[model samples]
Target: MKKSIKNLFYFCLPLLIIYVGLEIFLHSLDYEPKTKNEYLEKNKNNLEILILGASQTERAINPEFLDFNSINLAASSQGIYPNFCLFKYFAPKLPKLKIVVLGMPFNAPNTPKEYTSPIVNHLNLAFYNVNTFGRATMPQDYLLFHSNQDYFSSRIQNYFRDGNYSNLNKFGYDTTRFYGAYQAANYNIGKINKSEIHIENEHNSKAIHNNARYLKKIIRSCKERNIKVVLYSSPTHFLYNEMRDTNLVYERDSLVKNLMEEYENLYFFNDEDNSGFEADLFYNANHLNPIGAKKASSNLKTFISKIIDNPKSF
Candidate 1:
């Protein structure tokens, strides 16, 4: 029995080492979808503007719509943590960075603590230990022992099946749908019943507190580096506005207003005041369609221009 156990352990040790080494190698490489390095390589020193947030910002700002070179580093379901990581990575690279537009969603404040990307953590670790061969061992352990092997196998199988992993550019910007603005519009905000508004508000408030802390840190860091930070909320459909009215208008507005007052460099663009825009402009209650994104971008450009022209007025 002792000899059998020893043989089994010896057999598995080689497989364990190989798995860990592969995971570490993949982690060290700049391979994560929509990561900062990927964007930096494409945009480089030409990036005049940086847009950060979740999917809302991803879909809202199209670099083709503007004269300046812009890149959206937003990811789906990403909260302040990844945004902070992105800022830390890109801020130093962008010497000519003129503007940073942050899409401050209502849900940003409510992101759960465990919402970080496991993939991102691996990337960070690998990057941090780039010179050493053993740096990737940790991620390898995670892949071998902690992560779901079946899910990982499925991912690998699908990657080859769909040919997605073979094409790195597929994970890059999407020009057809304007980098996911069309998809954001498809997010259904009307599903929330009137009764659920209050519950969502209460939950969202807790998120807001978490959001506020991270936002404050981001703002402070930007200010220290002389980088301008614009805090803007994208236009939500009428139903979303109604939901906000039902539960979060006063609290949210007050929180934003206080931040604006505290930071002389911060600006807020609230779209709820305009009620005359066509409903077709919106894809849903929480996000704008392609046309709406264009309009919003135009308005933001004009707003930023005005701020540049008259710094004190902003």
Candidate 2:
């Protein structure tokens, strides 16, 4: 019995040591948590404007381009449910948070959208609240890592690499852009998963219900805090919509407009038909490159300045 106990200790000791070492290293490194963690630790105190969305907003909106003190909390592949959780997490900490600019992609209103990347989904899943990512709306990202070892290993290796903050300005804008790359042929309309599309079609009411719930949660949270919430759709190249379903875009805009009417604090900027995008302005079909981002940012600042100047109009 004593020999067995000694063997067990030897087996567990290295694992325990490795765990501790990893924890210490994670604290020291600028990995997945670094950007958001930095905002919480350093910028929360003085910030008035906060941006949230998927990668498009991360790349498009330069906080420096805006006149207000701002930070972009958008992450790649993040959805609205995660945005709500992030608001809940940060609202208490940021006493001065006055305005929240949330990116609403055309597909954002569609319910039960499958998370594209396991790593991104898992990272955001860490912020999941049972109330937000309930059984019906949320995909089981936790189970994905078990089936996809390569992706799981890649996620870990990415942590050890020096984070790509080169494109990221201090205000959390990712300045990376596909300059002069007219690669429209490479861009395609976002495809719906056949299986999930079937499921959504069958349970149409459930998808709509969850969509309303998540969107309202974000608006309500910000309303409670007296923070103005902007439902912003950043510009894309005219080719961006070439492959998309116009009916679907119309529905999303209608829903957003209805919500804006319902909530006094909520504002919507569709920008669907407003066009000035040349081939050089786009990184791909769905996102603007640096040149486009600059022009879009200038226009946004003008719009926001007017709104901020006349708070009563909203």
**Candidate that would win on lDDT:** 2
Task: Give the alpha carbon lDDT tens digit for every residue of 1-314 in model 1.
Answer: 99999999999999989877766544443243435456666667777777777666655555556656776666555567667666766777787787777877655566553454554343334432221122335535344224445645665566568744432232244433423322344434344344432213445556677778877887887777666787766666566566653335666667778988888777777654457544556654555656776777777677777766787886
Model 1 stretches astray by more than 4 angstroms: 9-36, 115-158, 165-171, 176-200, 204-210, 272-284, 288-295
The estimated TM-scores of all candidates read 0.69, 0.75
The parts of candidate 2 lying over 4 Å away from their true place are 1-9, 19-27, 113-118, 121-167, 177-205, 311-314
Q: In candidate 2, what are the lDDT values of residues 204-302, reduced to their tens digit? A: 345456767878987898899888888888876564555456666777778888998889988876664467765556675566777777877777777
The TM-score obtained by model 2 is 0.75
User: How many backbone overlaps does candidate 1 show?
Assistant: 5
Clash number for each model: 5, 0
